[model samples]
Target: MSRREFTQAIDFRHGRVDMTHGGGGRAMAHLIEALFVKHFDNALLREQNDGAAFALPPGTGRMVMATDSHVVSPLFFPGGDIGCLSVHGTVNDVAMAGGQPLYLAAAFIIEEGFPLADLERIVVSMARAAREAGVPIVTGDTKVVEQGKGDGVFITTTGIGVAAPGIELSGDRARPGDAILLSGSLGDHGVAIMSARENLALDSDLVSDTAALHRLTAAMLECAPGLRCLRDPTRGGLASVLNEFADQSECGMHLREEAIPVKPQVAAACEILGLDPLYVANEGKLVAICPPEDAERLLACMRAHPQGRDAAIIGEVTADPNHFVQMSTRFGGVRMVDWLTGEQLPRIC
Candidate 1:
């Protein structure tokens, strides 16, 4: 069937997705045209092909790809939903590689009986995020599962990017005497999720710090092209990311508790929940490891960016056969920041 066969438009306000929408029939086409394509309209997507194809400009440099799936509970949270989170997650992954994101591919797994209004809202949010980040969603797929078998919706986004020329970044590139820097406060996203899930009201307004960081990484590369490594402390938070750096580079890390920046409200919330802020998740933050000589300059540059305004030099790399991440406490004691033993938060993107 063609446009003419779609006699009536989808009742987005009152309609719920059913099996026929995923049956590769008229209903599927109608849904795609009325929902996904309508919001994600772009030159590449207009072709309506199985996959999007486009030409890369000259001197595009090395290509990088990263994919992530979002299944955070309570799809709609205080500051963000799974839609924008999906875009930011994969885009940040590509940025950590010193790459400039170009395009994105999204795939949705929606359950039967899910509200069309909510699905449309998600798609619209995703489109807005892609537009703001200067990346386009050029292709995608959709699948429907039985109501009880699936969550409300799951989003998987794949991002494609091009690395900056003459700059190579990797997890194992950190060396002894390098400096570690954090973008902003820790545990905002995780805390926001918990607050919404448990319906707790706090004195201060807390929201998820979910935003794109490609521009911030680009600025860091411009300021200190010799930066060794960059990593986003997402699910496992700052401690986990530092440990990963130590294990990969076979080095130790010495951190100052006072230098780490944690919002007072977040700190209080963590204390109340019997959780350590270091192990909490962050959506819009990054950890950068650079040579000791360039640390100050890079820190200055990062502090000037919106995404990194609260940036701080939290630690320094050291030579230790044991590869431990130790932190100096405000009370004049030292402790080991080891790998998280088990899952602190589940279904947290």
Candidate 2:
């Protein structure tokens, strides 16, 4: 029989893995076809090569690339884990530049004794995320370390995206007077993970906002095709990203406390943990800066989308040589939303 026919009939459902399963042999080929290919079965993947080859949508646009390493503590959480989070994280990084996420490559670093079932579950989650986002896991790599040398699992992801023509979006493009728009509530992702790990009691459905935002970003483009700047408030949260913009654009940002939305439970949890919600990370939200003329239309468009149901115009860019991010408190006071002094929380993303 031909090679294709031989692979087609491999038993996937009843397969018990061994070292040979990853040893580049018949077992490896069978494993790849039976598991990975079955889930990520797009035309490009059907070619069965080391890499996928495909064309971008018809447009003379710039290609965007982003990579991220996710070592979030617990592999599984309320809404997602490292698997789907890796996909959403990289996708948002590219989408923040007004790009549409097109493809992804994943690499897994697994400890020697990690459960095979857990690895399969993570792989399946990654596949599901890629398919749902209309992106493909075109290529991937896997490695195993000795029993005591590694964590349970770590995933690194790289994404390729396409940006529209004539669009110049960046941290340096946040001009004074530009309106700052937030896609939704803050700190959900970080809080959800923390609660899950600490086993803190909280209401159900308090899920991580881990999601792919390119589609919502596409909607933003539809309203304000000339979007000036965009960013995903991760790592150092909304505070750090805004400060980066302030430094890049040589501007200041004045945020209205009331305008920034945070779920009550997230706020309560932050208070209990002595953490600031503004400094906590979020996986699915985006902060966009655009001309005032486009703010109304952009926020309206954002609110109409499922990912952006809590969209709000949070702040405005200003001319401040110090490049500070200041805030007007809800209690009628002014203060500085300074750069993240030291790591307030680690392993946050």
Top candidate, metric lDDT: 1
lDDT of 2 by residue, 86-157 (tens): 889999888987778888887777776677667677778988899899888887766656667777888999
Summarize candidate 1's per-residue lDDT along 1-349 as a digit string, tens digits.
Answer: 2343688899999999988888878888888888888888888887778899988767988999999999999899889999999999999999999999999999999999999999999999999999999999999988889889799999999999998678899889999999999999999998888887756565458999999999999999999999999999999899999999899999999999999999988899898888899999999999999999999999999999999999999999999899999999988999999899899988777
- The TM-score that candidate 1 achieves is 0.97
Worst 10 residues of 1 by lDDT: 195-204
The alpha-carbon deviation from the true structure for residue 127 of candidate 1, after best TM-score superposition, in angstroms, is 0.7
Stretches of candidate 1 exceeding 4 Å from the true structure = 1-4, 199-204
